[model samples]
Target: MATSISFVGLSCFLLSLCLVCSLKEGYAFEELIESYAESYLTHTFEVSSLFASSICNHSTKANERESTFRVVDKYGPCFQPSLHRSVVPPSLTDIIRSDRARIYSIQARLSKNSGRRDLIVEPNSLGIPIIDGSAFDTLSYLVKVGLGTPKKDLSLILDTGSRLTWTQCEPCRSCYKQSEPLYDRDDSNSYVTIPRNDPVCEYVRRPVDPPRPINLCSYEISYGDGSVSVGFFSKETLTMSAAEKINSFLFGCGTDNKGPFNLVAGILGLNQEDASIVFQTAQKYNKIFSYCLPSSTSSTGHLTFGSQTPAPAGIKYTKLVAEKSPFYGLDLIGIGLGGTKLNIPESIFTTPGTIIDSGAVFSYLPPVAYMTFRDKFRVAMSAYPLIPGPTAAIETCYDFSKSTSVTVPEISFFFKDGTIVGIPGKYSFIEYNTTLTCLGFQDGGDKHSIIGNKVQRTMEVVYDVPGQRVGFAPNGCS
Candidate 1:
């Protein structure tokens, strides 16, 4: 059976830590701002922009001035605190179920051969189709970004596979429940609605008897999970840090929305689209970005735009393959278990290639590859006692409760150009204390394979869009 955890208990736990850290010597004021931002988003606390700005100004270093944002995992301790560390952790069955649902939802969306459409077009230029709901409550990483005049801080899901940044606005025709209040346009002094006379508004169409033209720039976006967001596209001032702010930022003001958006205010798109937040600010940051996802849910990660000085040593580099899909695709040459390479056909990885998505929780591989890898892994772990055959979405699980340490073989991801990245045992297995651990990989059907966030943890993933390459380096993210 699945059980839900309370946010109140979690917030209190995190709040206590934040308070203690604020008084520490090495702790900077920015950490306090981040903690306050998390509390405001999760508990609806009233955090003033002036306070946030003051904290940022105090923490700003002379040489370290750049546009950067703090990224927190949705299930991280800072975001969702655990009641007790020694107590049995949240149900792995529940976590696996949610992860599988997300995978299925993504697969369904990819199955559709919807060709690329023009960015600006009639509302129905691309057929409006209904999506089936399967994976609704998937965990995602969140980032705090400020928008509007007085800088209303909003917690948005950080998505590398999406292109549009959006949030629910006031005067919503219909909207789903969210932890924070809907953004009120009237309160923003820098808010500017796209006028009907603007060329951009011509592409917007309204649903009516005659399909009349919309006076405001409108947009409708549908997700793989059957959730849809529809509203006018407008411009507002976007604030990143105390010193960084962008004017006339294009974003969707969702008036009607639905689905398991979780507790976030909206989605922040990081795809390579022209209108994406990353692209819009690329020039300012020199088209460079990197993120280090923590291995454990208790640690907080960071996402930075622009250059990272003195790049981490011994970084593995791979060319970013160009694909029609709005994801970062790479040629997966092979996968290795321990020191032995699996004799799987390379053709299985061609059709859909492999996508490295930060939003996905589980790594998915072609069925053949998955089975081969699983069999090899099982053989490698023959020494350990097998606990169970199946548990929800996970087929293989083990009981390490009686043992102090388990020796699991290393899993390696072989990419093109002879670039090999190995995964340590700690990363390959999901440890629920000293007892329970499960394989982090899953079967992603025969069509597509995805390198989910789980496998990408503790690695500094650098997406150099302009350079057309992605680099990976080991980092202690947890």
Candidate 2:
């Protein structure tokens, strides 16, 4: 029996090895053989039986057995599927130029709108456009998500700060310029309009003219950066890849959408909201997701869902405070310069707290905290000569032309759990040009404080919603 099983497994392995070598043109022969040998041992019993069955019928139909083996060998995870993987492509670096502008716009909006002001819009005032010439152009990370049957690929901005994933659909009353073709419901076989009675349809608040039929649910969402999307709330087949296909996935099909959306199709919301893609696919993914934002714009990063066990060692964990809805909030207690702790008031840090956002570029602090940090930073680097920033937006810059290397103090963030996250000088001071380096921190006024994407670079930030905490580990993304 042992001899028979060994023969079967060996025969199957050799056949698969030869087939893979012929089909996979670029793969090394030795590597392929080694991989198949490992696979054969892992699925030994199944492969032995499968090979015996195939060999028995090989004389009559050899092609069928070869094809079956090919499919089995190609997708190892398909046989025993695990976590869903999605690739987030890098965004245009020129979008980095719009970072300061986005910060200004957000600050202005927060100043005028205050708390819950943007959410409390009257039903009659729905159509009235509040036009602020503030451009919504901001540095964004993008991911290509396949939706609907037959899979229409859409480029969406990956935002952790917002909820409700939306895309511009056909039958557009008004729309913005998109690089890709708009998603047409007619082309999708699995498309379904969500019934108004469904609990998911409650997100739609716009009063229809003369009250249209309750069968079609509608939605309206306004962004803090002055971008608004109003359209139908519906469910369709959402495909992450060829292997992963989600049915009855609810998403906003924007009919009237306007924003500084650039050439992208829509937004992929990964926030802590019921309507978000992360929450909708919680059962499949276990409410776990993580990302490592690359330091350079040239390199790409990954967005993974489900399974957080493979994380690297020495990850610092902190509780995700429930103060901010949708946005992930962390309790920031104090700021430290080198080894010395800054004497800024605890109230300043606690009042607004610190929100970790992937959408924003620069880290922001309250006015008092910012001034204290800036003053201390300046004093620490008093010996170095100052230079004009590459852009008007960056105020603090230094001349690094003559020196081989510039010595700058490390800035650390003190959290409530007595954990300190230290930022190296290289990360805190960004190289604007060949000879100039500018400070990455900005004053967020008094109302809001944010830890932006620039600060998060090269770090493995794990958002473990099921565990109700966020974990961070050094990943060399920079």
Candidate 3:
């Protein structure tokens, strides 16, 4: 009996020893994998042309002297303090839905067969009002600027797709809650209302049965998601900074406004149009503007107008199809991932062509192109374990909680003029949280491919409107 008891104890001791050894070995193996991931990512960023440009240099921060406004992510910590207490921020799912809605709205607007009735159309002006609820909400970037003589600071959405720069004004019939006080034209000495006979008045879309406010030039703009702004088009002293101010700047003062406009005061129109600040201040800035969208909400980015906008070394230029005026269009020839160039045909991109929008959060490719790109991405990321994303819209996701670092392949956009815009792994995949990350690209459908802000991160996007070309350079901001 004693010998049997002793034997059992010996067996238990041996089992415990084995378990301890296995745990230690497992921890050591985990450490090894983590070390490899870090080294691989460092090497990839160092060697890959997509990240090798001056823009990728961490040493270079955003230049404040020439920058018109410091761009901040709307949902980021830096901008959160400015939001109204009653305002509720959208969730990740809400953001994805709004983004898709915006893309579909763009497709509808561009479609010739679509029976959507027009709202506001300015024939002589750059004031083609784009109506989509997602238009304002999905715009993740905001810039602070002053609109009146006394210089009341206002936070406005910085959008390239939009034309009519507008803000909520006093004597509001209906107004949504905003971070700042509404602009009162009565308070500003520089405020000038447009007359009915002015050339700019032609830009205001006339309703079937016009409701003209006598001598005042009134405009009505609506979004698909049930957001609308109706107000008078007028000119005021536009103040960018203390050193920068433009007299007789054309903009909309929304007396009646309602929408999911978040906490923003208004929109900063950067489109190719007479009403856009780009064209309005053309002589001073030469219709050339460049901006760097921040990679994260905690960080800061820059938006610079005119010749002062920095064009760092290794900047690539691509032809802009200005025929799609309100939207900045470019020819997307092909796409490449890692060592392999994607098998998608050029016709896929050229059908409706591609437009790069600053308002959007995710890039949308055609079905075939998106699938091929997604499949290739999956294969390249096969080493990492697959995981479910926060939303169904984002299909490609990975679990990196166990690992200290993540290694992803480089995604490159090949343009018609051989201007290759290389997207680094960090920019290619969005880290939803510490544990999960998702591919930044989405299927935009057959109509048109839209390049959203996600892939444009870290690079300085230069829109040379007069030059009729768009340029991409590295290391524009932090």
Question: Which prediction has the highest lDDT against the true structure?
Answer: 3
For model 2, the local distance difference test gives 0.63
Candidates' C-alpha lDDT: 0.66, 0.63, 0.73
Instruction: Provide TM-scores for the models.
Output: 0.75, 0.70, 0.81
User: Per-residue lDDT tens digits of candidate 2, residues 277-343?
Assistant: 7898899888887766644444444566775544645678787887564568888888877745689
For residues 12-70, what per-residue lDDT tens digits would candidate 3 score against the true structure?
Answer: 99988887787677975677788766444321332122212212222134445543788
Q: Which ten residues in a row have the lowest lDDT in candidate 3?
A: 120-129
lDDT of 1: 0.66
Worst 10 residues of 2 by lDDT: 66-75
User: What does candidate 1's lDDT look like per residue over 1-478, in tens digits?
Assistant: 1223567667788998887777675466777777765432111111121011101111112124357666665544555322222212235554556665555555554555433342221110001122342333455667778989888888788777777888999888888877666888989999998865677544333323211136566777765434677888789998978988888888888888877665667888887766678777876886677777754555556777886778756678888887634567888878986645689887777777887887766688888899999888888778777666346457666766655555666678888777888766556665443445678788887767888777777677888887778888886343
TM-score of 2: 0.70
Of 1 and 2, the candidate ranking higher by lDDT: 1
Best by TM-score: 3
Model 1, C-alpha of 26: deviation from truth (Å): 51
